[model samples]
Target: MAAEKSLHEYDVILVGAGISGINFAYRLQERNPELSFCILEGRHELGGTWSLFKYPGIRSDSDLYTFGFPWRPWEEQNSIAQGARIINYMKESAAMYGIDKKIQYHHQVNNANYSTSSKRWTLDVTANGSEQRAFRCKFFLMCTGYYDYKEPLKAIIPGIEDFEGTVAHPQFWPEDMDYTDKNVVIVGSGATAITLLPNLAPKASHVTILQRSPSYVMSQPSEDKLELLIRRMTWWSKPLEHRLIRWKWLLVPFLFTRFAYTFPKTCRKLFGKAIQAQLPPTLPRDPHFNPSYDPFEQRVCFCPDGDFYECLRSGKGSVQTGVIEKVTPHGIKLTSGDELHPDIIVTATGLKVRFAGGMKLSIDDKPYNVAEKFIWKGVMLEDLPNAAFVIGYVDASWTLGADATAQLMCRMMKQMRKEHVVEVVPRRSEAEKRTMTEEPLLRLTSTYVRKAKDMLPKAGSSGQWKARSYYYKDIWMAWFGDIRSGLEWVRGV
Candidate 1:
């Protein structure tokens, strides 16, 4: 048996040392000097997804210009960054903030139980489960992330169990699995498969990507002149530097939304013109990539590495439009009666989501599950008090949103402390209101806004929680919105 260690407690417990957790800890420490924190990370290292994915062309889907911390923006001058650089960025963040000590590595959380009577939580965790440790904290932030865990996939067709030369998920790619000269079949088209197609096509004999349906893809120069000019600005006030870049790209949308009510046609034309410029008419082929939906509907795919285009031009890559019929011993059979022999198959499928660290939450033991609840102020949950989780725009720079969330969380915590309120929960609604309000929130002008209502933490049908998707409006909201207006309080016992 391993030697027993002393128990510990803290004012706040953050799970996962990834972008969200690390940022939260940093902001919390800065905002509240007296509060104690302990961060529990399952992985041995700092970078979460960045460390986990080692596939050939692994990288961030969003441009690092705004995706990284506001104070430490990516000055690499590339819109889309490689997996390695992202990991390095995380390391720099940990070191710069002195967050290493707060992180208890190899501590995998099994279950965390909350006790409202005591207004604290007991986190039952084990490292490799050979030994266990218990930690108590007044507040818990679930930064395990919506996509931390990998999804399970079956052949869906017959005979996949035996004939497969090599099959794996992109998240769990083996270290020694050689793809050189091997025919590789990558399934799915979300971000992972799109990334793998270009990276693997060169090394492998050939790469065939199977897409159930078409997703919009945009190709930009991997390195742009504008990006080169930005790196020199990183050491300066980084947030201001990042904010300038964010506002620059954000202007077209801002103008469109700001005057859209009065000048819808002109605003629309400006955006349309921008799109037309990028996909110049001189080039042939359908502009499915241009997308019929308005911007920010589903987040646009970013492939600045130019690998996607390079592979297609070289004829080493093929992007098929359709679903899979089944996986044969040797290869995949498409619905179109096409059979592609692949030496290896990778399922880059989507993720399954749960709420609040996937932990069973109880407020005074009322049994809280945030998955189905309405969000308030894009942070707090209804029927739960003294609690909130980070859920940002799935289509934008996630860390940008996360940074704002960390700052907002600090403010909320301060309110709780100042008022001596022990808890804050949202009021439940009747069945008459089953979906989001038809009138969209001002900040959330994106049509993709509709896609996340099930999970977004909105402030209310109005107020900050009303659910706005516009970045500027949210920047305004996060900075100036009356965050405490909707907070229903419970007196401490």
Candidate 2:
């Protein structure tokens, strides 16, 4: 017979140990010192995405200045960092804040049920593999990121299984796999594929980026030159300089996004010109560099120091635009009768969207489908009590949105404590259901987003339930927005 599971309780429980969860832990601890909390991490390590992904030249597409925690700013000169460095940075932050001790590893939350009678959440967790455990908390916070950790978005390449050459996915990269002097073909035009091209080209005989259509590829420096100039100003302290650099990164991306949306044609022309400047005279900007969508419609892939283009210019890597008719035993066959017989094929297709880490939720024995519901304030779900999840911005550094949400959550928790409220739920009226049109909270037209449209949360046209905007506006709303207007607070049992 199996042993009875142990029961533990806390005032608050965090469901991840990633950047969002670690940041939230700091805010929760600093803002509400009296409240007891614990972080339950499914993985053995702390860095969620950074710790999980292990591929050649895996690094942050976003600059590390804003991607790093706001509390402990990134001190490194390189704004673009590798996955291992990011993991170590996060570890240092957790240790410095003593958040490391509060983490419980190998604790996977499979199901969470909120009881109205008890006004508490009971989480059914699997710890250390098979042993079941139970945890009860007044508030539940999900920092589990949007993508599925266990599965990558399945690339529907016909006859992929028949390929005699080694096939791999960037999500689950095989360690120590050698491709020395071997021709390699990477499928997709996203960040992963772009990153792999330059990284693998030096070692491989040649590399080819196979894509159905091109995405905007921009060149970014690993180190910020403007930051160096700012640091040279002796009037400012190191901390002040760091803050200035951070703000510079934040505003630059924000302004770029605004410009791209406001003047897409102009931005597109500029992007094309920049790309053309890097490409050889032989390779025109028509089919490979030119994108079907405007800039910022989908994410623009950034390569550090024009490395991707440099590889192309050096004749080490190349880009092929076409549809994959089938994967033959030798390699890939294009719909246009061209075939690539590479030694290795890498499917750098996108990620599969997964919410709440795929944990099931229920309230008073009634199942709550997150997909069918609407998100309130980009943090809390409608009709879900004492629960909040972090969803970061697609355009800017994810940490910016996460920290903003943390501040908002802290404010809500403080208000609840001040009023002796046990349960707080975001309640929307029937008029909202009828009048407000449904919109996708993830405002991207990317293939991955389009494929999982039915699974994401709904956004309203206006008001508190409207779709999430840019970081600056969201941060403002977080600090001073309406919190009690559409909320129902229960004080006592």
Say which candidate scores most in lDDT. 2
lDDT of each: 0.67, 0.92
Query: For candidate 1, which ten residues in a row score worst on lDDT?
Result: 439-448
Q: In candidate 2, where is summed lDDT lowest over 10 consecutive residues?
A: 1-10
Per-residue CA lDDT of model 2 for 330-434, tens digit only, reads 979999999999999999999998888999999987899887888888889999999999988888889998999999989999999998999999988878878
Residue 205's lDDT in candidate 1: 94
lDDT of 1 by residue, 319-398 (tens): 66656677777877777898888898887765444344455666555666554565666666666655667755554667
Show model 1 residue runs off by greater than 4 Å.
1-7, 148-159, 227-243, 246-296, 428-465, 491-493
Give the total clashing residue pairs for model 1: 19
- Candidate 1, residue 401: Cα displacement in angstroms equals 1.6
Off by over 4 Å in 2: 1-5
